[model samples]
Target: MPDFTTDHTEPAADRVERFQAAASTAFAPLLVRAHDGPPFHATIRAQATGGLLVSDIRTSPVTVNRPAGRISSSDNDVYKVALQLSGTMGVAQDGRREVMRPGDLAVYDTTRPYALEHFAAPDGEIRTVVIACPRHSFAAGPDALREVVATPVPATRGVTGLVAAFFTGLADELPNVDASGTHLADALVDLISLTFATPPRPDPSALTARMIAYCEANLSDPTLSPRTVARAHHISVRYAHRLFAETDRSLASWIRSRRLDRIRRDLENPLLAHRTVAAIAARWGLYDAPHVSRLFRATYGVSPTTYRRAHSGGF
Candidate 1:
């Protein structure tokens, strides 16, 4: 195992520069802003075991951004799982904002943009354990991962609790190790894989929930349909329909509604103002511009352009 640690005695006057350099060495290049200004306080303890890097980050008030401009095509091979141990942090990614309290955990992809801001802790410092692994080392595929990204998983009781307990306990005991990560990496990978697995003999509601999650994760795919969803879950199209019958709407209707909803959401988001109406529509799988215009008029009583103007003050 390779270990790196930032000394706490380092002078605060120049800590920001030292912190950024140490951070980049510990993990990747991250845009770290010190909310407390000069005389900042932060420390990082990072350990590497094969393809996995576990980091214990303790810092004062700060906001971290993994900007899109900093990401390269070759730099997106890792996924980061964060376990909040002793503080509150707001995690923003994939259009979802989650406030993760102690014992809450979530995963995020390094390939995309994400932001994290730490709140004031009881001890005036925030502590979080983050583990990074190569995407190939993880069991879940990209599509499946989209559902869980930035989505907080409570660590009360279940596989999630087990993961939380294991990592938190590891943070407390890793200092005693004999400088070896013999099985630590493999165990972490197996634990995470178990967390992502589907439970055995799931009920109809659970299965339906899984199907809906699949749909939500792949809303941008034009080929995402009842048949494709059924195939993804290893069920027949009829069985998929039967499951959807339990819901208020049919599977196909739900898909269409969700796609339009995503488009409308993007149009209303000022952060996405750079995207054209057609581009936003296509991003959610509605590729036909004229058809989408008609659908928007029929659904919202306004064209997409007008709707964007009304909601987001034009794009």
Candidate 2:
């Protein structure tokens, strides 16, 4: 991969304009603005390694915005994973905000709206290594990725620290690895992905049981979902699904079955027979009438109304 470096002695304004264009060209559509005054300096040294676009940036104070108006399905799904090498950066997305210091890691989706501010230090410059990774190449699916966007993955220790160290080393090695850097790039991505994954547990069964218990307790909540369950259990959506793979049904189907079972129990209770099918369904968080009817018929070989009538002597 041939490296491209842009650092010219043009006027401060022209330098900003050219830097903004170059930054956008290097990544996706971005509005880059120089934050400090005249004679501002910046450089963007970019290289493509494996399937990743790595940009080593050193610039004066600047702010970058990814606007909603510029977002489209046709726009690339590559996410920007920034490793703060020097100074600080403020990141905002999905209504969450955080400031990243040196050795910190953060990711942002290109297809969504986000904001970034590269703040100047006492030395009057900030440096960052930004890697662009496509959605498919990433290990975490979209849901998991959304869980982490604009959220700082601190490089204080452990796997995150190791990942940050790799990026720091890659900055110097990137200029020389055009011929043999693909494997290294891939490993770095995998490690970073692992850093964002759920923390390890000694027993999958225990976690699964706890997650199931949470789902059962929250069945009356209309917003109950796999994602919500995962959040409640402090796990990943993918891991939550994996935990239920050996169960009687998939996680989603199991939730539906449990809700249907509760609805049936309620309908069979003679004291509760006055409640309508829709009302009973809603009581158990099965809110969509037509969809719930289809599920109920498919599961019990009868519609909710028929089942309720037969169970309660013609309700």
TM-score of each candidate? 0.59, 0.61
Q: Candidate 2: where are CA atoms >4 Å away?
A: 1-9, 200-315
lDDT of 2 by residue, 1-315 (tens): 234344565667777787777787887777878775646677777778787887888888889999998777877679889999888999999876777888779888898899999887777669999888888888888887788787666687888889888877777776765734678778978987897764547599888888888989989999898867865664546667888998878898888899999998998988998778889899988889999899989999999888888988776
Q: Which residue pairs clash within candidate 2?
A: none
Give Cα distance to truth, residue 237, candidate 1, Å. Answer: 28
TM-score of 2: 0.61
Candidate 1, pairs of clashing residues? none
**Best-performing candidate as measured by TM-score:** 2
lDDT per model vs. reference: 0.79, 0.81
Candidate 1: tens digits of C-alpha lDDT, residues 1-66? 234444557765467677776765655667887786435777677666656777888887778888
Candidate 1 similarity to native, TM-score: 0.59
**Which consecutive 10 residues in model 2 have the weakest lDDT in total?**
1-10
Clash counts for all predictions:
0, 0
